[model samples]
Target: MSHILEWKTRLYLFEEDGTTKARATLDTGTTTLTGHGAAHRNPADTDVPEIGDELAAGRALRDLGSQLLDIAERDVESVGARSGERTDPVLGWSL
Candidate 1:
């Protein structure tokens, strides 16, 4: 089965009031899913824009990944119910 498809995702980050915020959006043509995250700078800590950006972006992407997995799990259950929790055969771990 050749299912040649492409999904595009866009991530945006911004800093405001000593906080760095990030938004990750996945565009699948039919619908869009978004995840948000933020990192706050402590008043006593050193100000590092890069660190904040990295943290915020990583968190946003992590959130987005979780949402994507939930969608897949739901879709799988809709068409054909699973006897039990899904697991990766090779890894022998729960999915």
Candidate 2:
């Protein structure tokens, strides 16, 4: 059987206070992205901690997505070279 190992990512988001929030740990086995923030919302303020959490989480997930895409692209190129497959022009030949 051909053994294929895959990388996995995990993301977590939560509120820290009434107006503070965080997005913690975008992990891909060996790498992680973390973000924190203070929403600074008052009784009359339009902002909320949930907004902060969403913003932070979105940013973290975007970063993680980019990294994961890079890893996948590299792996695909590696496999294509090993198997003598014609890779897409955009991907090009790695070696």
What TM-score fits each model? 0.85, 0.46
Top candidate by lDDT? 1
> Lowest summed lDDT over 10 consecutive residues: which window, candidate 1?
84-93
Candidate 1: list runs displaced more than 4 Å.
Answer: 83-94
Clashing pairs in 1: none
lDDT of 1 by residue, 15-64 (tens): 99889999999999888999998999998999989999999999999999
Residue 59 shift from truth in candidate 2, angstroms = 1.1
Q: RMSD to the native, candidate 2?
A: 6.9
Model 2: residue 41 alpha-carbon error in angstroms: 8.6
Per-candidate clashes, comma-separated: 0, 0
